[model samples]
Every structure is written in structure tokens, then in C-alpha cells.
Target: MHLISQLCFLLCAAALGNAVVLRPRDPVKYQLKTPPLDTPWTDKVGRSPWPQYPRPQLRRDVWNSLNGIWTYQAAAGAGDVEKSPPLLPYAEEVLIPSCIEGGISGLQKWGVTHMWFGTYFEIPQEWNSNERILLNFEAVDYEATVFVNNVRLGRNTGGYFRFTFDITDQVKRGQLNSLKVFVFDPTDDQSIPQGKQTKRLSHIFYTPCSGIWQTVWLESVPKNHITSVDISGGMDGQLNITVHSNTRQPTQVKVEIHGLESEYATQRWGFESDQLAKISVPGVKLWSPDSPKLYNITVKMGDDLVQTYTGFRTIKSEVVNGVRRPILNGKFLFQFGPLDQGYWPDGIHLPPTHEAMVWDLELIKGLGMNMVRKHIKIEPDLFYEACDRLGLLVIQDMVSMRVHTNARPSDAEQAEFERQLEIMVNEHKSYPSIVTWVIYNEGWGQRTDYFPEFKIVDRIRVLDPSRLIDAVTGWEDHGTGDFLDNHHYADPQCGTPYYSRLSSPYDQSRIGFQGEFGGLGHRPEDKHLWPVEGAVRTINETYEIHANTDSYNWRAHVLLDLLKQQIERYACSGAVYTQTTDVEGEVNGLVTYDRRFVRVDTQQWRTDIQALYSAAAGRA
Candidate 1:
């Protein structure tokens, strides 16, 4: 096994590739927001703001909290675009750990995209030179650049994955040091994976988020520290773990395994060359969606220790018992669940809280869904962690920034799009719950900006051969992708089984899953929503006082009824219900926008879901 991130940084150098580059400073920017919280005991002078522990995967003690009220200013979207803007008064005040666009961030999640944030802190004189500094960002949209005082540290792209910078050399002990970050995001632009984010909130897409969407903090580590680690164990009685370090060489590297009943499991091993080790046991326990059994894992190169967990499972779409089905642990199991469009009413791109992350799947479980297709947007890693622990299967979708905006990057744009896509694939390829990858959603932004790109089917196939990939979701079905899929709005026509029969040459199923259906509307009251609710509106909000949707609902309900008719009519495979909750103005979610109300009774809804999934599981 190699460093999970070995390929993550192997960009063809500009000297070799002669790539065109842009100085992000060319765009106007906004300074950061630092709102003062009103906590009775959470005053800025005393308590540590955002003092919670950072890494949930590997827990530890003795770290510092860098979140708190900080100074900020907005840069002229035009003036001196290449340089940080000077501080301005009454610019904006917001909470440290929240994005400038999120409600909790003490900033609105609307009408703001370009901005910069800065904060200053003094290094404690008592701290020794033996300690190294680690500056971590949970997430920052689009592009980011970091500077200490005035010296450039490092830069990072890709909004989904966590990025870090070593600032030890820039910070002088016993002296005040300033940290600054610049961010720019074209919400609906043809670059970057903005997921369903839009400058204007509506329909399915919610408000856009700029700057930090997650948490930011500072940590002190020994000079020789563990940079990163990838822990994965497979079902064939094989376990693979790799550890990355900041030093050139280490004296020793070792890891211990536990949880398996066999004594061979609870032992230690050591190695070098990126410090990865492999262990295989005979007759290992296999993990399935039904029984999501995970094991404990520990890693240590020297003095540093990191703990995590891994599940042993393999996913495949197979014809078992003469039926095309998603096989898990060597058994046919219908993958069924909500189309999880991870969004929030108040926070937009940001989930309101950490627990806010689990509601989508918890509601799915309540509705008897064993699996979920996390449509179009890759969620924060915590969401996957919950799926791994909660026993729900996930078909993760890669984000699309240019899809809705009709972005047709010239061959140049297309090339950049591919690069961004590669970043997405490598960053998220490791999760156990992700059984499939969705290359395109409804062909939103095709390369032609018109026709479909059959090559997409091939692109997805190459990126992640370990899992299933769907090149396009709604229309223009290419004879590629691991499965078949289509969208039906007012007629819930679940697709056909004959299609599954056509892919036998590839050992793939012709049957396509209903990538979308069942968009029943039910909005929440007093949600403080953004203006211009999406076009997916009732089309006539008051046409019928008591009716679902005067234009789409009554017909949508009848369409769902029609779909149920077709489920048994076509003898289909499976489906992913339109959405889990209402986003912005679209009220199609199973739960209301506030997440406080369930549109349908929990038990009855679950039963409805179970029937659709089980029936579609086996495509004969």
C-alpha cells in the first residue's frame, strides 16, 4: 500500500505542463467576519470559543483553540485585486467558526462571495522550540491562500477535503503573529464543485457559502509529527493501513490491530517507505448493509498515536438468483433510501449543526430505507462516519459547479474541469459507505453544453474501478455506467429491466435505478427564507388552499401513484426518492425545512419506502 495521498499532490508542474494560471487576487475580496457570541459564560475575554475537540476520527487531548472574535475588512471587488484590502469600519461582524454566508456565521448566506479574513495571536513564550505548528481548515470553498504576517505559507483547492499548512517558521515565539486567508467562489460558475449551491437560492439548490464552512484551528505537534493516515480493511480477510509523516525518516513505525476474535488480529507490525503495513487473517468477518460491523484500529510510528475504525465490506451490482441486484456480503439486497441533498434552511451549504448532519439518514432509517444515494454533493466526512456506524449504504455524488450555470469550458475549461474532477475523486475515494460514484446529475452541464459526453461513462470508470459509477443520472442514457437510470416528474415511471439485460457483455446490469422521483412538497412556516423562491414552486401558491401543489403537486401525487403502478408493471430494479428535506423555496423534502416536522408519519412512510426498494432490488 502507498500513501493514500501520494497521487493527491502529483500535479504536473507548471514548468512541464505550461498550464495557465490566475492570481486569485485579481478578483475583489471581502475581509473575514468575527461575531461576538452572546453566551452568558462564553465571553470573548475568558472562555475558549469553538473549544470542542477537532478530529473525531482520531481523538486527542492537549491542543489549542484558535477560534474567536477577529478583525475583518472587505476588499474592493476591483481595487488592488492582487493584494489584501485594508481594514474597513462597520464592514461586518460574524462568528469565527462559521462561513460569511451562513446564518450562524453571524453573516447571511447570501449576496457575499469574495472576502478575506484575518486574526492575530501571540505565541506563548513558555512554549519550547521543540513544538511544530499545524494550521488546519475543515473546509473553504473554491480557492484559498494563506499568509503569516505577510509571508506566503501555502495554498489549497477543493472545498470538500481538509487542508493544512505548517506555519512554524512564520510564527515567532513571544511575538504577535497575524494569520490571513483570501477566498473567491463563483457560486454557479463553470469551475469547482459547488454541488447544488447557487448565488440565488431556490428549487433544490440552496444559498451559496464562501470562506470557511467548517472549523479552523491551530495545533502544536512534535517536530517529527504524523502528517496524515489512511486506514482501510477489506472483506477478504485483508487489512491495509498507511501512515504519513512530516519528517524524512523515522526510527520506527508500528501499528496494533484489535477486535477480531483470532489472536493474530491483536498484534503489532512495523515498516517504512511511507510507513504502510498489511495484515491478512483467515476467515474474516464480512460487513454488509444489514450488519455494519466495524473494527477498532490503532497506529503509532513512534511517540505519536492515532486511533480509528474500519469496516470490512465489498459492493457489487450482480445478477443473483437470476435477478440484477446490488450484492453486499455476497447477498442480494435492494439499495433504497432518500435522495440526500445535504443542505440547510438557515445555513445553506452548511448543515446547521453536527447533529444536523445525521437527520437525513436517521429519517431515512425511520422510513425503513437501508441505503441512500447522496445525490450530487459529497457531504462532510462526518456524514459518512454516521453511515458507517448506523448501517446505511451511500451512493455518493460528486459536486457540479458548472452544471446548472450551463458552463462549457472551452477545451481549456474542460481540461480544468477534469483536473478538478480528479481532485474530487482522489479526496473521497476511501470511504467504506460510498458504493457508487455519480459522474453527472441530469446532464446539467455537458461538455458540449448541449449533447452528452459518452466519455464521462469511461472517465468515471477509470477514476474509481473499486466501486460502481453512473456517468449521467436523468436523461441521455449511454450504454455505459454500471446501471441504468432515468427521471420522471408527473409520472413516477420507474425505468425498465430489459436495459439491465443489455449489459451482460460487461458483467454489468442493464437495469437502471430510478435516479429521481417522488418530489412531494411540504414547506415549513416562519423559516426566514431567501427571496425569489425557486421556479419549482407550486406554480400557483394559492390556486387550491387545501391541495398539495395546484400545478405540480396534485399531478405529482398522481405521478407517484402512477409510479407505484409502474413499479409492479415494469418489474423494475430500485429508486432514489427526490429529496430528504425542503431546500430554500423547494418544499419536496420528507421533513420540513426546519427539520422539526415530518411531512409523513414515520412508520407509514418507512413502509412505503421499504415496499418500493424491496420490489426494485431484484430485477428479473
Candidate 2:
């Protein structure tokens, strides 16, 4: 059988005009370099970049953060299951939660496919009360397999979702316990949902981040604790609460509602079953950009307790004045914000600090924008939490892959992509800030063959009926879903005609949305700009800085005014600007890549934005 397999491999190679199989060569050793650029928080990143509790939705006071320095070894091949975990007195150290390729990690090395991360932690004496100790990773790039004291916990795939393991049995009570993680990230070399990451960075695609890129921590909970929480049905007076527990045994759960507004009193309700229950808010305060009201919820099941917050709001597409538009809280409020690509010069996918994350959202709110399109990348839950708290509506994009648009993915790849997509929706649907789900972007990895019959968008709707779904962000629109979307660059345009690349024409039945527009890049100052060595520079509408008129700001206002006129001419609901910040090589940003400077006049732009919204309201 071995000989036959070898013969088949040779025959296939010959057919493909390629050489036969050979032994693998030793992996290349790339020199690591420190990044030149830095954010405002870089100097203050300190020992722990992310010290906050990883999971804000499910809060617990009894927890320990495992986010500091860790030793890591890198290799350039697919991980082997037969190989044992590396025994370490490792020479190199990387800051936990930052990708190895990131400068904030202290080692900016690339081309690493297989990586091993090792650290140590001690279990507190207070956490030994018949509780299950859970080891949680906020996110790991591509694939990760965790181990404790050489005992393998399990494996988790997907780069942008949180994964956890119950490590009660593996951890010691008082003494130190060793933790090891094996990570595999092939970047564009493999067929996976990688968003805008590419090994060979060019144009829109930027540097690829491998290994852990978010927070890691530990939490203690009861054996029968609540595993998941789903908060929905905010449209009506009642809010739906679904609690998923570890055990299937019948148990009673108590829910306490604390209103953020002082006018309402705390309400308590008891449920006979842990699965699902509907609780009524005494004063149903509809959450909107104008009035963002949040309610704190506490769930208690015997010894297990968890806290989370939700807002009462509803999102839908309805016809107003003969044009379909986004109706938030049953009102016609035009949504407009930046196309936020949550990348940092220092941390890559992960921001330098939580304050850095909030800074972008705060800037958007301060600019008088009501919504932001999180372009083709899933941010950590804290980002969504900030949006929720700051009253900015979100249009979340699913990560795109490197798959060919004309062909179908392998059965396994298709299943995995859908699985990650489902997980993204399931995990983040509870956030009231997220009102729309963008399933595809510009046909990046979209499968055109699987169209009308494609149940992926339908599945997302079933998973989350509360949010509007963008079936395809820019192209290959199936004429289904909630919005008719298009992408225009350098300048703004409406989604009425479906653009040139889209498969179908505009559907008046759906809401018209300009997915992307108005890049309007300004040349960065020498000290503030990212080093342009091997970076690919694509020329757009770039302007020079002028002190008198501020040509950059003037250009931005002109384009925004044009956008307003186009929205009125085309009768579109809203639009997303090119981006919030300039990514690597993509200079079209309202803010620079390093978060150092703003290209536009903030106060003037805020006034213009208010005028845009006022124009939209005048039509209504």
C-alpha cells in the first residue's frame, strides 16, 4: 500500500508538470525586528497590555489574569499530533495576548506556522471550594491546542472566537501549575477565514498575525454553572433571557434586573427552568443613539452566579417615504460612520490597550456619527461593549478567507467556515450595539456557486433574528436579506443600481446602503508615518496638509457633502466611509495608522455630520 501511494503521488506530480515528493527541508530561521511605529499607549503598555477581565459579558470577581510574559518557540510547518510538547528553558520571551509578529509582543518575527507558548500560574486558595476552574483564551489565531502539566486539554479552531476548557482536574490548589499552548496559523498559505491578513502584504491586505492575539485568563465557577447566556427580544416590552448550564439536571434560576436610569426600580424574577425565560423591564426604555439605556442583569443558580448587561432596542428595515431604510427603535435615523478596520501599528489585530480601543469609538461618537461598519474583522467583545456603552450602532463583518470566488470550498472547509460564522453570531448576538451582520465583503472568499439555495445567511437569520443581515456586502447579492449594498472608493455613491460588479440590480424592496466610500487619505508627517520599506502604496485621493484652509479637512468636507447629496439623489439609508484609520499602505483614513493624528477638523466635521443627519431627517 505504501508503494502504491508513492507511485500515485509521482503520477499526480508528473501530470501537474511538477517534481515528485521529497523529504521536507529544515524550517527557515527569520530574524526578528522591533517595530518602528508606536501608539500613544505603547510607552505605557507595561508588563501587561490587557489587564482587564477578558470576558465582560459574563463577569466574575474571582478570577486570575494569565496575561504577562511567556516563552515561545516557533517553527515553519504544520503541527504534528505525535510530537510531544516542548520542554522549556526558552531563550525568547513574548508578551502574552500579543501576536508573535506584533511589535508589542517584543518579538516581531514572521513566517512562523507552528508555535508553542508556555507560562505558569498558581491557583488561589479561595478558588478551591468545589468549583470548576476554567482556562479561557479570548482568542487565538487559526488553531490552538492547550495543555496543562503535559496533559492535553483539547483543541480549538478559528482565530476570532473565545474558547475555554475546564481545568479543575489538571490544576494544583496552591503550588504553581504549568500551562502550554500549541498554535498553528498558516495565514494565506492555508484556506481559512483570515480577513484582511496576508503573508505577502499588499494594498488592502496587511501583515498576518499568528498565535495568541488577545487576552488569556482563568475563572472559577460552580460545577453546574451557567455556560452561556443569550439576551434577546428587546423590541417588545419584555426581554428574553436564555441561560445554558453545564448540567442537564432540572434547576431553578433567579434573574435580577438593575436599571441604569434612576427612575426604574430593581426587578427580580424566578424561573423554574434554566434554559429559557422572559422577564419584563418595569420601564421599557428603548435604547437608541439618542438615548442609550442599559440594564444590568444578574443570573443566579444556586451557588453559581454571573453578571451581564443588555439594552432594549430593535433594528429593522422598513419603507419610509417610499424608500426602504433602517428603522432603529421604530424611527427613521440615518446611520453613518467609518469603515473601522480594527488594526494597530504596534499590536496588529490586538490594540495596545483597552483605552486605545475605546478611543476609536469615542472619536466616532464625538464626530456625530451614529453607526460604524466593522469591516471584515471580528473585534474582541470589549470593542462591542464600548460601542454599546457609547451608543454607536455596529455593522459587524464576518472574516473573509483566501478561497476562489468561482469555485466551491472543500466539504471540510465549507463546514469549518460556516461553523466559525455561526460561532461569531452566537457569541456576539447578545451585544445591543451589533444591529447588523455583514456576511460577505467584496467577494473576498465568497462561493458564488452556492447562491439562492445557500442557507448560510438563512442560518444566521435563524441564529439571530434580532439583527439585520447583509447577505453580501458589496458583490454577488442574492437579492435576499435586508439590504442592497455596494462599495465605492475615493468618493461616495449609493447602492441603488447595485454597482457594476454585483450580480443583481438594485432591489427597491430592501434597504439601500453604500457599504464603503470616501477614502480621502492625507499624507502623514514624516515622524508619524509608518515606514514604507516593502509596503505596497496604492494611490487614491491623497491631499497635502495645509495650515490655512487645511486642504485635507476641506477635501473631507467636500466628499462628505457629495455623499450627502448622493444619498439624497439615490435615496440610500446610510454609508460607511473608507476607514477610521489608515492601515498599512492604505492611506485613506480619517485618522493616521499610529493613532497619532486626525486628518480632519473634529469640531467642524462634527457639525457637518449633524447637518447630514438633519438633511436625512428633513426628507423624513
Candidate 3:
């Protein structure tokens, strides 16, 4: 009776306008994450575990695959309430490691969050007992309330970084156990890290992806597991590694260095050294797209062993002979690459397979570019691992949780923003590939900087000061990070070499990153399309009345040529072309949405890219 009265009162308050029921209003657009596995028109193999690599960038030989169908259904409400009635058949299914809003899940429509997914599986008995059970979630947008069996386990909110929760208490080996997840995303509601997603898909933005769109799996690790790893290569050219564990245990962890071992000297000490280890490789070749080189690393903690990899590299900017430019390995170098959406038709933001992730990086390198401004999103560690292994430089962006503002910080939103920012930096500080941190995203829904952009810059300095920080990209520059940034479209442009409009009291120690410039209008068409609609807004000029060439003109070749002209026109620190591939409504890509065809000739594009880079470096 007490509960019933409270429920009634809550409904009354909702009717009075304090709450919203969130009726299922149709989205103006929908992104198709997974199409039919067996497309009637293609030679693609339809297989479970679409992305096969456990770590796309960081390859490992021993790992289990956990991508396949998990019994799923949309609940009317409270899908797993202890006393709630069972959910109806749903007649629908969602693929594991895929978002509910995605086509790959077999449930293309949206609006509900109570998704019940169940799978029966077993782990070797040996994996339990002495070892701990860790459930790793690559990403689950907004909110992921997890359950093991009928017990409520735990929950996580961040959508970009990797998270692990111990389930040893609830999980049983060689037995059938149920795993349930509930997700809620108020996309662009100023509550979550909903970058550029809108309910009303118009202009350049498109629909939002709700539930899980990344890998979900389980791994067994010994009680004395390496919880975190921090990697860095200093001026001495020695690779440094610091490993943190769950328990001190005074464990003698064995270290295996892949490259020239003599160059690096290793000493093992328990919690005392914080268990720090260093290795040197003389004549070490730094990671660069043109001369891609990588090294491997394996660590053994107690009786447990884990294999991973890292690179030894450094990036900085300074005035050289009266010119400012980015430097790598003591040479005035130019950084050029793409704005990788990191999304795919098969997986939306989630790559279809591990191979899929590798393909994007490899292709970027093949294009003769070295850096990728990983635009407004954080990727799984494996993505960073890949960048580290394949010798790619990345400017990582912290996930934005609130709109930015110039007003004083009165709202908790600022605190929340800083909270997530710190978490991101803490988790990813170890990677050698990441060199910069991008704070506010496009001024999207900015309110107030939790810490002013510059203050936050100082905070990052205290946290992991080795890299640079760009407080805000393209606008509201508070002189943070180490670069001047600008955004242009369909053409080339550069900030003033000495003092950009945003740079006041700017030091020459840092230069500018073309950051964003070039919406080259190229379409690879069919294979790599985000969706046919975004690609064919108005086909051939005769499809619809809105198809006027002057207004709705997005024909293929015209866009590609425009991109070519833009790339040739601009000279900046490094040019991040509009993008690596097409996203939902943004058909400007070197490749189509489906990850198939290269709209531009690979060799020609590479030559042009290298030439422009050479020219830019010369000027710098």
C-alpha cells in the first residue's frame, strides 16, 4: 500500500510536468549498424564474432572470442524486475557486441531501454578459484546496469573507455549463467557524452545510437593481476613501463622486452618501485606513418602472464631557426592524417571485427599520413594499442558529458565534466601513441568549463604533462594545449604562422594543427556507405523535387574533386582531411560508409599527401 501510494504520487508529479514519459517519437533518421549478414549482392562472409581481434591495434595470440547472438527482447518496462511478468517474444533479436538501435541487432527500431540478453556459457574450471573473473566492456553508451544471474552486480556510465568489474562472487564456471543489461541514453540531453547526435536529423547531424555497440565478454585472471600499465619513451630513447596490481603481494613480476633488450635495463621490485621497469633499444626507430615500426612487450605477474605491446616515441613543437613546427625524433616533422569517425556500417561506432579496426589504421598509414585527430570520442584500449603497435600518432579527445558555457561554474555539470575527463586521462595515460587531449567538443552544448580550459590545461599538466592539451577545438580558445586549431571546409586555409586569432601571448614552443579543414566531398558509394540516404540525398538530379543541383548537389565526382582541391590548397601543421570514411549524413569521405571502395586512387592519394606534408614541413 505504501509503495502503491508513492507510485501514484510520482505519476501525479509527472503529469504536473516534473517528469517526462519519453514517448517513442520516431527519429528523423536511423543509422544502420549491421545489415543482413548474408547480403544477396556481395561476397562478404557472414560470420559470428564479426570483429575477430580481441585487441585490434594490440595483437595477442591467446584470447577467447565472445561475439555472437545473445537471446534478446525489448521489455515494456523493467525487463528484469524480480516480480515483473515475463517479456513477450518480441519476435526480434539483437546481436551481441552491437547496439540495439543498429540493424545488425535485427531490431532496427528504437525507443525502449529494457533489453534482456541471455547466453549460456562455461569457463574452464581451472580459470576460476585461484583466478579472478573480470567482465570487460569495450563500450556501452550512457548507462549500462549489469546483472549476473538474478543478482544485481554493478553499473557503469562512460561510453568510450574500457571498464572492468569483478564478477567472481556471482559467476560460476562450467554452468549456465544469465547476464542481463539495461541501458538508458538521454542523447545530447546535456547528460551524457552524445557527440553530435540529435533526435531531429537534419543539416549535418544525424540519429543517436543507444545501447551497446562494442564488445562484451569475460576473462579470467589470477588474483595478482596487473590492473594498469603506463608506458612512455623518454629523451634517452628508453621505454618505461609501470604496472599496478590488485594486491602488493611482494610478487616478483618477470619482464620481457621485445626489442633490443640491452638498450633497456629492467629491475623488478614489488609495490615499492611501484614495480617500475625500463628497457632501452638503441637506434630505435620512432613510430611514424611513412616508416611504420613497432615493438612487442609481455609481462608476467606472479604465476599469471599477459602479453601486450608498446612503442617508444616522442612528439613536441618548438621554434626552429625562426620557424615553429612539430618535431618527432629531433626532426622538424609534419603531421598529416584524417578525422577518423571510427564508425562502420557493420558496427556503427563499433567496428564489425578486430580486423575491421586494423583495416582503418592500416589504410590511413597506406595513405602516407601519420596522425589522426580522433575527433570527440574515446576508443577502446585496443584501438590505442593498435596505434601504439602500428606506429600511428593519436590526439585523443576526452568524452564530453555536458554543454560548455562561458558563465561561472555553478552547475554540477562542470564537476561531472571534470570527473569524466580525469577518468579518461587516468585510464589512457599509459599509451605511447596518444600525444594530445582535446577538451570541449565543437562548442556543441558547452556550459562552463568545469575547470577553465586553461586551468584544465594546468590540471592535465599535473596529471600526465608529457603530452599537449587543446582545451577547446576551433572556437573559444583559452590558449590551452600546445597548438592553434582551425576548421574550414571545401578549401584550404592556415592560421597565422606566428599569432593566430585565437593565440594571445602564445608561445612558439607549440605550433598549430590544421586540426580540422577539408570536407572534401568524395563518395566511395555502395560498399562503405553509412546509409544510402546520406549518400544519395538526391540521386542524378531527377529523383525528387528537392534535387536541385545548386541546392541539394551531393553528386559523387564533384565532391571528390572539391576535396582534391582543398588538400592541395591548404598548408598547416598537419592536415586532418574531413574524414577517413562517411558517417550517417556526412558523405564526405575518402572511402564509402561500408568500408569497401577507396573513392580515390590509393597510390595517387599517397603521393599527393606525402608531397603536401613535405611542403608543410619545409615551411614549418
- Lowest summed-lDDT stretch of 10 residues in model 1? 34-43
> Which stretches in model 2 have alpha-carbon errors above 4 Å?
1-33, 79-81, 260-264, 403-408, 452-454, 495-504, 536-549
Residue 513 of model 3 has an lDDT of 54
lDDT per residue for candidate 1 within 75-193, as digits (tens), equals 54633336643322124444566656654555554555566776656666665568877778877776777777656776777676678888888876765566777776667754556
Candidate 3 lDDT tens digits, 1-620: 25653454345334333342332321122223445221222223233655555444233333455566655655555435443222211233456666565566556656665555544455656554666777777777767777665457777876665677888888666665556666656665445665655555553554556677677777777777766666676556676667667785456666655664455543332332245566554665566544545656666767666666556566676676565666676676666778876765545566656667788889887777778878777766678877876667888876655343333334565666777788888888767778778887666545544336777788888887667677776666655567766655444344433334442333344564556655545434344445446335622221122222233234323433443443334324555677787666565566656665565566656766666655655554
Model 2, residue 465: C-alpha shift (Å) = 1.0
Worst 10 residues of 3 by lDDT: 540-549
lDDT of 2 by residue, 159-243 (tens): 9999999999987676667788889898877779999888876667888888889889999888888878898757576888888
Error of 1 at 573 (Å): 3.3
Error of 1 at 144 (Å): 1.7
Q: After best superposition, candidate 2 residue 559: deviation in angstroms?
A: 2.3
lDDT of 2: 0.79
RMSD value for candidate 3: 8.9
Higher lDDT: candidate 1 or 2? 2
Best by TM-score: 2
